[model samples]
Target: MRNTRSVRTHEPSFHQSALMDLRRGGKFAAVFLVLVFGAMGLFLVAALVIAKQSIPDRPAIASPPAEGVGSAPPSGSAAAATGQDHRREQLVRFLTAAAHPGQPAWRTWMPAKADTSSAFVYTPLSPADPGAREAGPGATARVRPSALTPAQTASMLEAVTRRGSVRPSSVAVSHASGRASGWTLDFVVRTSGGNWLEGRAAGSDRASGETVLSQLTYRR
Candidate 1:
């Protein structure tokens, strides 16, 4: 009987030990789950911070202020200066066309409001000493067909045809004057040939200037 009693007591102790081990395992599993979730939360927070840092700041656009409440109008002199600039630009276009004979119809070089009736006063340079002649009085003569001739066009392209030929290097208004009749401009066209063509342009109206090719002169 004593032996049987001892066996029962040992069996109950064994069962109690098993239950203790299972409780310890459950506690360990709960701790492991808590650690994994904490690491994931930290990783997610770091990713959000990195994303914010990677984004670039955009530049702010500037908007123009509304006109007229306190804005001052352009001065009279400024307006006149603008008009002169426009006339000079037109003269430069003509000089450029005169230098390169190809593209942009030769006649388009003339001002929109040119007076064709008024003949161009062209003066040819003496062939003997083409570069020696000066701008002199009585050197000019009125020609009926004011349009540029084939020979003149060839001469305009001379710089383009010579050694190291390039299109017109530069065009500038050498002289300009406003008169009762209209505005007169003298343009200097420099070419790749290292030579320049002197052209004279005149406008029909003085108030609202409208210039045209009145003269074209150059050295051979």
Candidate 2:
């Protein structure tokens, strides 16, 4: 063979190196995509846990009041009793202030103060005489307050809620000038029960002329 040189059928070293570098680059891209997605998933899980911990918990509300509502009395001494206990329950159990009223029906009354040490007095709706009972049958008893403390007066006033179909027609409290003491409180408790049952109570400390005026008007 006359001097014909066989051409080298081989790539340059630089070209071969470039081909190897391309292959490695493809693997690196795939691994980079996986690592990027995995980092995003971890960040999302961390965010969810932080949000869950941010919320605060609270307690529940209380239920409603009872039917008769035996709460603390506002004036004198609050008492708790049912409406049906008018006749049977001792009226004395409800006595509080000065006197239960009796009268020609005054329109207003001033009740005793929260600070006074005055004694409570009882004034029956009807007379203690048996004749008074004879006039009204089933109206067997009328026990007003004979004596009462502050709480006792509140108890008596609470009794107004008793009796069938009872409603407070008008309840008023007032105080007036007394001869000896500073003032006298008059509680004018007027109620309706198919008829009017008006009871009154007055009270005084060491003051004379302090008493309640009670009046009950029954209409047939």
lDDT of 1 by residue, 1-220 (tens): 3555444443557889899999999999999999999999999999999999999989888777787644786787776566567777765555455445555454563434355566544454333122213434436444433365655545433422232242334656666777435667666666566776665656644354445555554333
Question: After superposition, which runs of candidate 1 have C-alpha atoms over 4 Å from their true positions?
Answer: 1-73, 99-104, 109-116, 126-138, 146-169, 179-181, 195-199, 205-211, 217-220
What lDDT does each candidate get? Answer: 0.56, 0.39
Predicted model with the maximum lDDT: 1
Model 2 Cα lDDT, one tens digit per residue, 1-220: 6898889887669988999999999999999999999999999999999998987766677778788675655442221112112211222222322133232111122334442433233322344322234446434323333334444333334333343234433443332334222323333444343444444332222324223233232322
Error of 2 at 64 (Å): 31
Report how far residue 15 has shifted in candidate 2, in Å.
Answer: 8.8
Off by over 4 Å in 2: 1-42, 45-49, 52-132, 144-220
lDDT score of model 1? 0.56
Candidate with best TM-score? 1
